[model samples]
Target: KGCTWRTVSVDKIVTRDCHSKVFGDIVQATQPPACLDACGSQKTNTSSSCWVDCFYKAAAGPDSGKPGGKVAGMSFAELTAAWEHPFLPEDQGGCPPVKPKPPWFAHTTSVEQKM
Candidate 1:
């Protein structure tokens, strides 16, 4: 007896507002806030999810991608497009600010300006 496949529910998916062209997948992340330096609204586990999903899809190839990148078959362009939403609402404080921070440094910076 053995598990067949790894099943990640759609609900678990954290959609990021940003997109990446290099990688064909959503960019949702959950490392921490850069501005707040203490949880600026990043979804939990989204970063891991994004990483796994991206790797899986990449290894699967761009021509055989699924989900938003589906075109009856995965395409490089589609994969990249699918990765449009990388940050979930929780991951980010709603729409990304004029300037967004990387997941790892999302909530670890001080917003207060030094005089």
Candidate 2:
């Protein structure tokens, strides 16, 4: 009953500590509000993928080099782009913000102010 409602595989997303500062900040900012909910049975693990999906939107591109710098091996633009495919939304998709939000979700502006 937690964010790990879906257990995290460190190798997949990489440990949070391994993220570059700029990338880390982006991950924190765009995290889906659904992520804070208590764990339960669900058809999909949108709680976690929702966040990774959001990250992919911004990080999957030829120019994604900046964030991938410290995270990935060498410069492999097209290959990297192919690897981080964007998650398409289906049945409301993984893109929409959750209603009422999960507990303690921070307002974007508030988070920006703190940054």
Candidate 3:
């Protein structure tokens, strides 16, 4: 019961925030439907869409006939408009900086002598 209530509360908060003008505008500015569709088509796993992949492909600049080229059926202008938000300066609303990977530690294998 408590878990269900907490889930409902979180959902309501998210829905409310998403419906707000500021958040809605940001989402619309960043992820247009066409861009999402294009990325969805390219996904290896069709069950779910990858927003990160869509953002990268959409921000790939002009069409160059490459695998990750501009989305099909979408003009350069349209792509650019949809891609505007992701390219914004960090202070404005751009992607956060990537964290460095942790150092790798090798595991030691012990050899057992025959009894």
lDDT of each: 0.39, 0.37, 0.42
Using alpha carbons, what is the TM-score of model 3?
0.22
lDDT of 3 by residue, 1-115 (tens): 5554332321111222222323324433444567556555554332344644444443443353466665443456755544453444457654433443343533433454322
TM-score of each: 0.22, 0.20, 0.22
* Residue-wise C-alpha lDDT for candidate 1, range 22-105, written one tens digit per residue: 233232222123312222343233355544444443445434455555423345565554554343353543324234335685
Q: Which candidate is the best by lDDT?
A: 3
Tens-place lDDT per residue, model 2, 1-115, is: 5554663532223222322333333333443435323323431243465444434434443244465434432235643432332222323222222233334655345756778
Q: What is the lDDT of residue 74 in candidate 3?
A: 43
Task: Count the clashes in each prediction.
Answer: 23, 4, 0
lDDT of 2: 0.37
Quote the lDDT for 14 in model 3.
Answer: 20
Candidate 1, residue 1: the lDDT equals: 88
Q: Model 2 clash pairs? A: 1-39, 2-39, 89-93, 90-93
